[model samples]
Target: MMKIIYTLFSCLIFTSCFNIERNCNDYKTGTFQFNYMEDGVEKTGKFVRTEAYSIDYFEGKIDSSSVRWINDCEFILTNLHPKSNQEKRSIHMKIISTSKNSYTFEYKYAVKEGNRPDRVVKGIAKKIE
Candidate 1:
């Protein structure tokens, strides 16, 4: 039992030392591209972000959203001109890890209603400019 406990403790220590790199500041204000699946088809979208707003171009449709940063790695996006009740909802996004030109992120609806489960989706965005 002692040997088993020692091995488990050592494994936990080593794994805890491994950390994911998050250089979210480098991607705060830039043009980025990401892919998403729509009706079983893969589609790519691009967006331009500044300090206060983000403009997205997808399938010839343009959308603008307000950007509110919670911290260096987290932000909330609210549509500036929501077309429907669903669009009025805000999204919460977090930067999990980053590479040289891309960052992995997870996003979900910012607010939840009673009896509704949370659904988070992860994606990678590559900086273009």
Candidate 2:
């Protein structure tokens, strides 16, 4: 019947979505820049990870902040002096596309405001050697 057809159709879509290959270890090493949009302005920054466990994320002209990763794709960005909401921005970066010399990543910036949800940013980073 129609009901049987609808149920089977929905299951096909759901299963396909869950099958994408997601291994974070292969996608995590590089120097990346944030071409993220904040308050309708494009903000730029550089993130340098000497290895998998250590990184220095820098913004503006010359000031840089060091951060550490929990794993290949997840890391905590922190600031020492602590000013504005930038100090506590919870960032999660996931790889979407990869090639010989670059990768496209999708990221979400968690918000603390009660009325709004997290903001998502996506960009491609070229590998630096």
Candidate 3:
């Protein structure tokens, strides 16, 4: 029992000391690239984000969204010209971890739906410029 307790305590202490690096400020205003799957096909998209807005280019279409910062590591993105009701919803984005020129983020709809749990998606974006 003592040996097991010591092992568990050591693991808890080691994990508490490990911290993920988040340099979200470095990615606030830059061009970034990411990949996503749609209809079982993989596609790549590029976006340019400023402090107040973000413009995305996918395929030949362009979409714009407003950026409302919640903090240095989190923000809300609302479509500027939503074409449908689903598109009108705002997405909450949180930067989970970051490297020198890239970041891993999780995002989901800001508003919850009736009787349904929120679906969060994680992705990585690499800064291009």
**RMSD values, in order shown:** 2.1, 4.7, 2.3
Tens-digit per-residue lDDT, 98-128, candidate 2? 6666677777764455668777677876666
Cα TM-score of candidate 2? 0.55
Off by over 4 Å in 2: 1-27, 33-45, 52-60
Query: What is the C-alpha local distance difference test score of each model?
Result: 0.97, 0.61, 0.97
**Candidate rank order under TM-score:** 1, 3, 2
Model 2, backbone clash pairs (residues 3+ apart or across chains), number = 0
In angstroms, the error of model 1 at 97 is 0.5
For model 1, state the Cα shift of residue 105 in Å.
0.5
Give one digit per residue, the lDDT tens place, for model 3 in 1-129: 999999999999999889888889998899999999999999999999999999999999999999999999999999999999999999999999999889999999999989899999999999999
Candidate 2: worst 10 consecutive residues by lDDT? 51-60
User: TM-scores, in order shown?
Assistant: 0.91, 0.55, 0.90
